[model samples]
Target: MQRRRLLPLLLAAALPLLGGPVAHAQAGRPIKLVVPYPPGGPLDAIARILAEKVQPTLGTVIVENRPGAGGNLGADAVAKAAPDGHSIVMGAVATHAINPWLYAKLPYDPVRDFAPITLVARVPNVLVLNVETADKLQIRSVADLVSYARKNPGRLNYGSGGNGSAGHLAGEMFKAQAKVSLVHIPYAGAAPAQLGLLGGQVDLNFDNLAAAAANIRAGKLKALAVTTAQRSAAMPELPTLAESGLPGLVVDTWFGLFAPARTPAESVQQLNAAFTAALNAPDVRERLAKFLAEPAPTSPAQFGDFVKAELAKYEKVVKASGVKLD
Candidate 1:
């Protein structure tokens, strides 16, 4: 009985010699959560927040920014990492879904190179029209937009972040499904594209709901509909595009965590638990809400299935749209 008590005491004393208390941490090494985007973005912010929250359970988590190649750089790095669950990435729809078809020679296969951890959140895209343009065009909803574009082919043009951006693809998908020929004007980035819309350079633009939420509320832009499977809580009054006479149109800027392929199943489960718990924390959700993100915690299997579906969806959309980087 004494030995049992002393054993723990001895181990505690020897902890310093074994390289401090962290030696007994949950992780053998500090976990690396790579953000496939530049610092100061929502992904990076969320990575930092989750890292801090999970450190108690995961031990010394670190957030790394490895932005480039439209998120392929960081995703590739994580894909090639050892499958120990210590190296993971905060990957977005572009890195895992769109980029595979956008860049012809992608270094890593989204499905084969990584084991999904958990889906962190999804920021929906909204089809918004500049207030002034909407009034002049007399369009109030998605049906009106489609009807106007159909009657006046090529008369309506839209702006997007770039040629293959989610906004661009959304516009293309709308055109294909709605059978309209609205012109597309690619801008340097979403900001510039939004600016163009504001300046009436383009009649409308599909944009990340979070990015456009402020303007929508302020009445600078008229949000016709969201591009998510369901309506967003941030704007419950707005309907989804699926409800707006287009069931085939569903798009969202989704992101999630992933580990290298072949990571131990136990490790994946632990990580999923830690992240899902962190995502459910009120503080974490509040922080995400500030960025207009909706926390969508999902099990590993669910995330994997969702990713596969997104891959198939984007493949169809990209091929049909014919937008490729390489």
Candidate 2:
């Protein structure tokens, strides 16, 4: 009887140690960050940047590219993922904000389907025109572009990443604000849009600063103005749209990280902390600066608010632009 009592006590003593495996089970697994665009675009480039830096802190961050439907296809996957911390989408303005307004029926809700982590970075979209066209049209600044477009209404065409991309909305915003009639051309991605500008297929392209930085330096494309509240570091000499006579024409490509909805607040906090740290790292800052992107990290709650505000802001832009995708 004494031996049996001792055996029961030993079993009780082992229970705490046995809980280690159960705790490990609940510790979560590798996280998958889906990028809904093809490689080479600003979104994909930054996604890779975040992946390299964040994986070290996040245990295992697997970045998978799932490009389609102007970023909705991959984002849909993230929306349907389990509410654990195993999956997220490297969301951008196109995927998170503009798509909701452009598409009439979306498969997932931006606010309800995923939890915001942090805003990764923001890149100014620069107005780059074909060299020949810039010379022929006498377009040197935002005012010049507007005047020429207005003088030759419907003749000037502007290209964007896609129908619901930040570039498209920026152009639309420009149209509404400047009272100009430049035809909007939507490409599959920014790469194609860049090519269209170089090939003179499109009159101009509001492309990411990094993508067009090299071309601008080579004199292949003429950069009229950057579409940001402030000037871009890549080409500090270039003025902003607001400075070029169109005040309040600030449009930039903003990327953020998001986890599946219902992820524990603690986990979201941890992820945000890691991202914020990475953004502040000297190496990461330098790398972002090369692309003229500003590192922007914020608390999970703050990120959530930013997304909400962007959604509302873009909704009005989309309505004003009258861009509807079936």
Among the numbered candidates, top TM-score falls to 1
Candidate 1 clash total? Answer: 0
State the local distance difference test value for candidate 2.
0.83
- Per-residue lDDT over 1-326 for candidate 2, one digit per residue giving the tens place of the 0 to 100 score: 99988997886566434432232233556678899888876567777777788765666667899998878999999889887667788888888888899999999999998899999999888888999998987887777888888888999999987876778888888888899899998998778989988999999888888778899999999998998888877778999888888898778888898888888776677778777888999998988787778998998888999899889989999998877997
Candidate 1 lDDT, tens digit per residue, 211-323?
89988998999999999989998999999988999997888998999999999887788889889999999999999998889999999999999999999999999998888
Candidate 1 segments whose C-alpha is farther than 4 A from its true place: 1-28
> Considering only N, C-alpha and C atoms within 3 Å, which residue pairs clash in candidate 2?
none
| Candidate 2: regions farther than 4 A off | 1-28, 40-42
lDDT (Cα atoms) of all candidates against the true structure? 0.89, 0.83
Output the TM-score of candidate 2: 0.86
